[model samples]
Target: MNLFSDIRDLVIDTLAAMQGAGELPEDLDFANVTVEPPRDPAHGDMATNAAMVLAKPAAMKPRDIAQVLAARLADDARITSAEVAGPGFLNLRLDAGVWQAILRAVLAEGADFGRSDLGAGKRVNVEYVSANPTGPLHVGHTRGAVFGDALASLLDFAGYDVTREYYINDGGAQVDTLARSVFERYREACGLEPEIADGLYPGDYLVPVGAALKAKYGESLLDKGEEDWLEELRDFATDAMMELIRADLKALGVEMDVFYSEKSLYGTGRIEAAIESLRDKGLIYRGTLEPPKGKMPEDWEPREQTLFRSTEHGDDLDRPIMKSDGGWTYFAPDVAYHFDKISRGFDALIDVFGADHGGYVKRMKAAVSALSDGKVPLDIKLTQLVKLWKNGEPFKMSKRAGNFVTLRDVVDQVGADVTRFHMLTRKNDAPLDFDFDKVTEQSKDNPVFYVQYAHARVCSVLRKAAEAGIDAADATLGDADLARLGHEAEMTVIRKLAEWPRLVDTAGRANEPHRVAFYLYELASEFHSLWNRGNDEPGLRFLQEGDPATSQSKMALARSVAVVISAGLGILGVTPAEEMR
Candidate 1:
């Protein structure tokens, strides 16, 4: 199904044959040889650097090797012409039937056409949107959620065993703050004047948590001290907020396989066990270190404390695990969590963090490397802020979220599909602007609409074909005489279609899911261009007047574009629209 890989394999096999015939030396390291689409279509279909790369190693001239390789490749039935250009670069033109064959392959495979076995079923753990479980998720969490979910799907489509995970930040002082905030609401529910103190959550979303606490505890424990109620309310409020978080994620069509609690690492000896693992590796020591350049933590004084030698493992400084107050630092539990993940036997780990967590990247990677002895690779992806605009001005925050816009706010305004697609239209580290006016427009400038319109257009074609009684179902389209689809406009789309499998492989390997969004945009652009041409040049249209065979051939090509777009959008976790509103 991967035409690029197939062509590359053919080029490699032809080189091996040249060696067998004594025309070239044996074992010239063809690993670096590549066959790729040429930059300019006028040059040829594919350009290979086989001759250019092997010239020095093969003790031959670049033009000499290219001349021989070109003749041998031209003999193959798949390649129509192989010409040497620019000092041994080989530009090849495949038989016109090859593009048709790739289109038929798309119809045959449908949703699974571009899937790859690149991961070889290796287990990969993707942790994202691990926002504090203190309130409903906000817009910052939304970008991480969409990016992480799409990345997990992309890795799965690339044949990895993926587990979507969310690490709940419920083990810190923030939970205590949540408890105190909910306690004020609880007092309000008890019909008493509640003291909504400073440094407490003031969102109206917590109003229900207070009512629920009163309903459960009654008036007996109403005036209890903080010691009696802090722990219990912390647990209760954490659960309530997690419920809200889950609803927000569900509204965006995200489902997590695990919700690991940071508190689970405490009192369970997991953190100690993880530190002991590092201790056994001679990576833990008691040492006094330099204070950081920025404003340092109170516990970060230059005193001897139990520290992990993270500098040896690639961190900027050795990090203290135990503070001067003898309590664990914030990083201890994170190290333990990744240790738990490594012990779970994942071959790789990926963490999706907010752009604010960029400072933790090196230390966290160092922790995982030390914990797993570098056997497990960790990649951290940071999603930057999303600036929302409405009516050509900056959007206001949600009062329900207390000065920040919640994930539900964005989803409720523009819908989940639009939110998801627009979030991915930019790279994870780049800032994104979600314009309400632009995203919902009917014009081609909007990527989500343009791509969805392509799929919907194909559906419209299928309907017209069915109404015409031409029987252009997906089942019959693959068997059409696709050779009739030889126009440059139609073949342009087929050339784009042939790049899907290669695109998925490259994007998955690089851990960049935004490439899928970009590819779909390009594919849609080509399809839309072809469709616009059909208005004036009747022969370029999907339907022909009274010619079912030619019409089916063209329809097959159009439907194949939808098939690829559906597969791409599926990886992005956005459902392809069958019909646009």
Candidate 2:
């Protein structure tokens, strides 16, 4: 049960009663009325802005309105006390039984306690980790993968039909560069000294791909010219790189529902269709854009080209759709891809891009808006950089990736669970420092260890109770007389549990998975604090020597806390620790 929503409804009902009594006008809109926690805990448990929002609309003084609303709210059983505070706000303190019922609901629901239906079954397409198929995934891709995967899970829990997608950049010139790089390795495998050129990939990760090429083609293509083997090598190398990327993602426990190819837009009418849709709205035109302001490139020229009027849809400037040589711009295929998503009947589209792609956000959103005619909304989230530190210094680089740390290197050093949890400790757009020494340290500084320890502590309590023959199983605890749980410390734990449903809705609405991690850390902190309080007051402990019912009730509350933690961790793709090993 959402106690905040429950109490908000009570406040709304009381306002309606005031309207009936002519204490407030009938035409005042209550949409802006909100009930939330007071700024100071000593003021009240919950505060409402009913008087402030309605005062100007109803042509009445705010304090006069709050005084009448407070009297009406105090008549409800759920509201134990209501008073006007400051200028106009109405503060409310809910009855103790309301917090008590929330604990019982959590125990009854298990891991499903905080699941919400706010999405109402809308279809959402989440596209992420669309890296070029030139090499294996690196540490940057790991952060995007974990963020996107957890976001998809969060929307799913919030009742959205989420589709995880990856856009393969196989149709780009980068894949052609990948072919030439593999060809050099192929020569090295064929008993010839390879040319390690400046623009060629020099990583040793492609050694196995070259070895496999030797196994497949042998010496047949050894003496062939560039034209005879370029296409074949391009196809072979692209497929091999994709296989490596998939394995890298699997190592990090990420799976996509679909892998879309940029090549699919080639020789297809999809690009024309998407452009035509924009042209029909007068958004496509042929014109030369003004040279970008300040420090113009040497090659900047006023050449006429096909452009999209992206400025009409909130972009800073009109974007080019075709180069002067008549080749499609890099953004053309992207427009077609999002058009395809719209055609698939998704209500919304979300793209997770790196911080470097921040420049592409506006034009892409303009394209989708024009193609869908404002029917489908697009949200683009840009993830910032990750800095790696160890031994009191920055980790230099990865030998396999040649430029950065590969996802495999991080996962191999610390297991996937630790990597995933640590990556989400910050928001997607915020810069994160991944310090190897700090993350793996077994202390409160490590969030992954701290949260896992809370779950393990609850397990230890149950195990001890079971050894004492106290029937401490979930089924037994759920059926216990919860009214015996009257201690203030015990009620604090229950109140925190009641915030789970509200927290789920908030995080899902903002499309921020890091909030779930932050919330879990806060919940663990509260649980740990209550555990320490038991040391000062022995009667507040989970185990009471002479009272079975009271002990079972307290255990029930602790178990309920465990249930919510497990559920939140599940959304983060983290396995709740049964015992810390």
Candidate 3:
């Protein structure tokens, strides 16, 4: 179904014949040989650097090898012309029937045309949106949630065994803050003036947690000191916050396969075991470290502490696992958490974090490397901040002003489908602007609308064909005489359809799901352009009044575009619109 792969196979077969006939060297390695669409369409349909890569290895000039390869390729029935160009590159023009066959292939395969087996069913764990369990998810977590969910879906489409995961930061001081914040709300729910302290959460979202606590415990915990109620209240409050987070994630159409807890690492001896494993490998030791470079804190006295030999594994400096105060640093539990993942037998691991965490990437990678002995690879993607816009002004997220935009706020305003699609329109490392006014517009400038419009247009075409008493379903269209779809405009779209399998492999290999959004935009553009062309040329229309065969052939192409559009949007967790509103 992949025309590029099909053409490359032909090129390899021709090269094999050249070696067998003694026309070329017997031991030439063709691993670097490639056949792809030329950068400029004027050059040719396809181009290859086979001769250029083989020249040095074969002890021959590039042009000399290209001249022989060109003649050999031209003899094939599928190749119309194979011309040597620019030192050693070979430009190829295939038979017109080749494009027609691609159109028929789309009709035959439908949405399954672009699927690839690049992952080879390797198990991959993608951990993302692990926001601290302190409150409902805010705007900062939305971008990572959308990006990671789409990435998991993309890898699944490329044939990877993907597990979507979330890690809860329950074993931190933040959960204690959450508990004290909720306690104040509980007093307020009992008709007392709640003290909104400087260090406590001041949002009204916790009012319900307060009310729920009163219903569960009455006034029994009212006068208790920290020792009497801290642990129980901390666990209770954290569970409530996680429930709110789960609801928030569901609003954006995200689901997690696992929700790992850092607290689990504490009681099970997992952290000690992980550090012991590193110690056995000579990667952990008690040492005194230099002060941080630039400016020193007021209490900048050096002290001996337990440090991981992260420098040997490729970090700026060996990092302390335990502070001089005999407490675990934040990075200590993270190392143990990933070790837990490694022990679970995952072939690969991916973490999606905010751009503010960019400085922590190297040490995290080094920790996983030393822990797993470099057997498992780790990829951390940092998603840049998202700036919200409304009425051409920046919409700041400030909790005190009660003006902060939560994930629920955005989803309720625009919608989950629009939110998810717009979030992925840019690269993960690039800052994205979410304009409330722009995303809902039905204009072509909005990619969500543009892509949805393409699908709706195909639906409109199918309805029109059906009203004219023609069978327009896929079962009927797929059996159409697709060779009749031979127009240049029609063939142009078919050529784009042929790039889907290649696109899937490229996007998956690069660990980018944004590329899928970009490709879908381009595919929709090609389909829309063809639809507009049909308006001026009556013969290019999908419905032929007198010839059902021609109409069916053209309808097959349009429906095939719908199939691919649906499949691509599905990977993005977007439901293709059957009709534009």
Alpha-carbon local distance difference test for all models: 0.94, 0.89, 0.89
Q: lDDT by residue for model 1 over 1-581, one digit each (tens)? A: 99999999999999999999998998799989988889999898889999999999999999999999999999999999999999999999999889989988998999999999999999999999999988999999999999999999999999999999999999999999999999988988989887878889989999999999989998766768999989999999999999999999999999999999999999999999999999999999998988777856775756789999999889999898999899999999999999999999999999999999999999999999999999999999999999999998999988988879999999998899999999999999999998988999999999999999999999999899989999887779999998898888888899999999999999999999999999999999999999999999998989998999999999999999999999999999998998988
All candidates: CA RMSD in angstroms?
A: 1.9, 1.6, 1.9
User: At residue 240, what lDDT does model 3 achieve?
Assistant: 89
Model 2 CA lDDT for position 118: 86
- For candidate 1, the lDDT comes to 0.94
Q: Candidate 2's residue-wise lDDT over 92-152, tens digit each?
A: 8878778767877887778888888888999999999999999989889999999999999
Per-residue CA lDDT of model 3 for 479-566, tens digit only, reads 7787788777887788788788888888999899999899889889989888889899998988888898999989988898898899
Q: Clashing pairs in model 1?
A: none
TM-score of 2: 0.97
**Lowest lDDT 10-residue stretch of candidate 2:** 486-495
Which residue runs of candidate 2 sit more than 4 Å off their true CA positions? 296-299
Better of 1 and 3 by lDDT: 1
Please give the range of 10 consecutive residues that has the lowest summed lDDT in model 1: 293-302
- Which one wins by lDDT: 2 or 3? 3
- In model 3, residue pairs whose N, Cα or C atoms come closer than 3 Å (at least 3 residues apart or on different chains), thus clashing, are none
Question: Which residue window of length 10 is worst by lDDT in model 3?
Answer: 395-404
